[model samples]
Target: MEKNPAVAFNQPNHLPVCDWLNRAIDQGLNERTAPLARALMRVQEQLTWRYGYERMRPGLARKYAYAELLGSNGPVISENLILSVVLFAPKHIP
Candidate 1:
């Protein structure tokens, strides 16, 4: 049996989510990691760009950390399981 790399999203030695976020924080860090900084920045600006100099209250991001966000690489796909008298079958099992 051969392991398919395409189906292994978020796996170590593969594209890491932290790498993506790191590039986003610093535009000149590395082009390969933060290729979509412009788009991400635009989305953030649209969501929270009105604060300016006016004192604003921080909400969810107050306790947010780079590790927390980067550690959220979701599973490649959802998997289900079924149990029966004969044998259990899992959706992810080939």
Candidate 2:
């Protein structure tokens, strides 16, 4: 398998949760959805950091990395929301 050029293994690809949230808000993200969006971003950052891009395979059918932030166990303290981040391999078809 060839390395994915989009994945930056040596550098951080995602911004910090607070920075992301602020940017989202500045970009016109609905105020009502800010909390949920923040939580989702946090989960995404955690997953990406946990599984570096180098560890992810690049293909259509290969296994992907995922992380689930459920209820009180995650950044969101709500029992109703479940935020999940699934990092799929970038499949470039040429």
lDDT of every model, 2 decimals: 0.28, 0.41
Number of the top candidate by lDDT? 2
**Reference-based TM-score of each model:** 0.23, 0.29
- lDDT comparing candidate 1 with the true structure: 0.28
Model 2 lDDT tens row, 2-93: 23212222223342222333354444346776676566554444433234365444442243443444433443334556555554433442
Model 2 has an lDDT value of: 0.41
- lDDT of residue 46 for candidate 2: 48
Q: Could you tell me the lDDT of residue 60 within candidate 1?
A: 20
Tell me the tens digit of each residue's lDDT in model 1 across 1-87: 123212322322312222243334465335763644554444332221111224534532222222111112312222332111111
RMSD of each predicted structure: 19.1, 13.5
TM-score between candidate 1 and the true structure? 0.23
